[model samples]
Target: MTIVNLDHMSTNQLLPEVQKAMIEAVKKNYGNPSSQNAGGEETLGMIEKARASVAGLINCENKKEVVFTSGGTESINHGIKGVAFANTDRGKHIVTTNIEHNAVSKSIKRLSQLGYTVTSVSVNDKGMVDPADIAKAITDETILVSVMHSNNEIGTIQPIEEIAKITQEKKIILHSDAVDSVGVVPIDVQKLGVDLLSFASSTYYGPTGVGGLYVRRGVRIWPIMDGGIQEHNKRAGTENIFGIIGMGVAADLAGKNMDKRINHLKNISNFLVKELPNYIDEYHLNGDPAKGLPNLVSFAIKYIEGESIVLMLEDDGYRASTRSACATGSLRASHVLMSIGLDHADAQGTLVVTSGMENTKDDIIGFLRALKNIVKTLRDISPLYRKNQ
Candidate 1:
């Protein structure tokens, strides 16, 4: 009855090397990065090195463009608000996708409440935002277009480069919430033609509560947090010295092994897709299987509650998820699933399983075996399932 956990969407398993780096950073903590003292200089040096490492991960030419924040949510807030505030004179209209994370959606809602215009472009059944749709959404008043690089719930990889081209041609700023895509997938801001990109350290094996944003040089953005000048005056607050250092180490590891990890996850995912049908009946795979992150798989088991299935799996020792970690407490259906054309009933039955380095082929097979039994048990008590049978 032992269960295998398959809900590692937030981050990959941390390697021993990463753990060692974090310990070293904790022991080397010197005071204020802005202090004029020698220790301050050392802290500042560490912070700068971390900045360079982050910049290198995204192929950013200038390390000064990267600004550290608490995590992806904070980075998203700063990117959206900072750009919006700085470009108010140009236009108040902003563009984004309907499937964006709450970080982007809530921020846009707040902006709309504040008297700014916002446009949420719709996605197709595959949860993809068409770049042409983004171009059409643009107007003379459009100043920024923010699209996530990948959907968190369904693992749909958006057409960011095409959207970037359109935005660049129109002189509009393009930003991507790459929190879900950065560590698991390869990213290059220059190659992607993104004006701004946001990512978190935890998404790739670094510690939580630390993230960063890449602002293309010459892009004007106001500081969201007001305090002592730090992060080249782009963001102002006392830096999380240890977190930043840990992020540096994690980024280096991610960049070095991204390709191998991606391939490994792909193998694991393919096995799941091939074997899942043997255990469960009448299920739907969410999103485009061909164009998704290697480690993520979202599916809907008809006539069963996602939460019930998650709990059932947990009881057996598995740790799968019902939806985005942010939406677990809510009763409402997932916005991402709804955006991709799933009805409320189908959305409620959705489960998102994302793999990490710690997961293995045997782990997936074990999960499938447990999952099949759980679904069968749940469907036995469901009136709808009985009627369908």
Candidate 2:
């Protein structure tokens, strides 16, 4: 059976270009980036080239501003904690939204534990953050404002540029987790006015476990880990040579095919948004449909458990996910969904559909068919569904 994979937000298949690039690096470039030998020189060149690729993809003014990290989580951790610690002399407060990924929200929460005040601003029902609300949240003690460029769960895009203007006017550091937006949409640090930006390679079909943090030139950030001088003393360790090369190739591919991919993702997501509602009894779109990521289509279906629908669809050769955060065999409703004012029950029933390079129109049709059948079967025996009638 042909399997339809729409869980792109979790992870994406490595693109062929990325795979080939990594393979070449593994077979030929085995030297450490810090070495001064010939092999190391070659590897260093490759790393720099990949850095340029990443910098070009984001339209960053300085390639040196890009520091490679282990992945999105590390980038976010460093971005949030780094800026907060570095700028504490200015203030001990950081501001962000409640709908951010676990990386951003949790990191900020950790800071709040360290006696730094972190104010998590709420989003509107559409999962969109109002710039006015952000402006109101800022105060004299606000040292850094970390916001996500796009949400991982609901795929809602935020106005980082507008938020940046406010932070800039206040001379506060602004960090944006652009992990979900890097390859899908255009990103320019200058245009966004973000002091620090975090991104992941997997989001762009690169190898997993390799990402980067863009620190605007002259922005002070304290290194989270200390050891060697790798990553310019920001992150210390032996770099993942193969992963970096894969990310570079992936960045090149994403830059070249961005428009085409965007159009494809939009078509796939648009079809689902328009057609999937027709199959479900009661559902509500969870994000700003008018202005959001084209690769995502999320909705909360009433009464039926989303996990059940996902399992049934999986049995039918379709793979998807829900907003429910599964941990240690227990399913917790997504903070993202709840932040948008969804009740616990509704949040548990939220289905998250994401499109990527591997998807096509045919895949979308197959997924819809399987989804319709699964939702019907699950609702037929659902105790909540029966009682709600």
Candidate 3:
């Protein structure tokens, strides 16, 4: 069976160029980046090249601001926890949205246990958090504000720049979990006005297990990991050299071909949105229709569980997701869906579809056709559908 991946948010296939780069790096078998020998110096050069490339992708003015990590989770943890620990003398209060990824939420939760105060501002029905709400949540004790650049579940892009102004005026630090946004969309840290931003290589066709955290010059942040002075002392331990090389190639390609890649993704996503009604009924679109990510579509199909549909679609060679892959296997209704005003039933029935540069319009059409049948099969036996009927 030919599989169509509509779950790009979870695992993006590495680009051919990225794969080749990784293969080449492995063949070379370079030395450690920290050593002073010629082999180590060569490895260091390659690492620096990757850093510059990744920095270019996010428009970080100084490449030194970029610190490599294991992935998005570590980057977020470093950004949130590091800043929180470093700024404890200033305040123990933090601001964030209700729809943040688990990395941000759990980090803040841990901090709360350590005597820190938190104010989680809620988003509107469309999953867009108001800048005013964020401002209102801020107080004199608020030291940092960590809002995701784009929501993983619904794909709603937040107003980071507007919120950045508030943080800037108040002399508070701002961090953005841009794991899902950095490579999928154009991200300029300078323009976004964020002191710290976390991103993963997998989001941009790079290999998994390698990511970066952008710490603006002079930001008060401590290293989450302690040991070597690698990553400018922001992160410790040996780097994932193979993955970093792949990420560098992927980042460069993403920067040079972003417009073309986005166009491809937008075409398929737009087709899915425009044709969804023709294939299925009794469904509501989630997220801001006009402002969400160009490559993602979320639908709340009534009267059936999303997992049932996902499994049934998989049998038909069409893969879909019910929520963030990181939150998979959890029986609880999505906090993100609930925060966007979705009731229990609709939230449980939510389906998240994401496209990639490799996905085509026909792929989306085929998936929709498969989904229509699956939804019918599930709803035919659903007690909710029967009662509603």
Question: What's the TM-score of every candidate structure?
Answer: 0.98, 0.97, 0.99
- Residue 23 accuracy (lDDT) in model 2: 80
| TM-score of candidate 2 relative to the true fold | 0.97
The clash number for model 2 is: 0
lDDT of 3 by residue, 1-389 (tens): 88988899997888998999999999999999999999999999999999999999999889999999999999999999999999989999999999999999999999999999999999999899999999999999999999999998998999999999999999999999999998888999999999999999999899999999999999999998899999988888998899999999999999999899888888888888899999999999999756889888998999999998989989999888999999999999999999999999999999999988778888888888888888888988999999999
The models' CA-based lDDT, in order, is 0.89, 0.86, 0.93
lDDT of 1 at 227: 85
Better-scoring candidate (lDDT), 1 or 2: 1
Candidate 3 vs. truth: CA RMSD?
0.7
lDDT tens digits by residue: candidate 2, 169-239: 98888999999899988888888899999999998899888999999988889999999999778899988
Best-fitting candidate, scored by TM-score: 3
- Candidate 1 per-residue lDDT over residues 1-389, each given as its tens digit: 55465887755556677788878878876779999999899999988998888899989989998999999999999999999999999999999989999999998899999889988999999998889899889999999999999988999998899998899899999999999989889999999999899999988888889999999999989999998789989888899998898899889989999999999889998899999888898889999767898888999989989999989888888888978887669999998998888888889999889888778988888888989999889999999998987
TM-score of 1: 0.98
Question: What ranges in model 3 sit over 4 Å off?
Answer: none
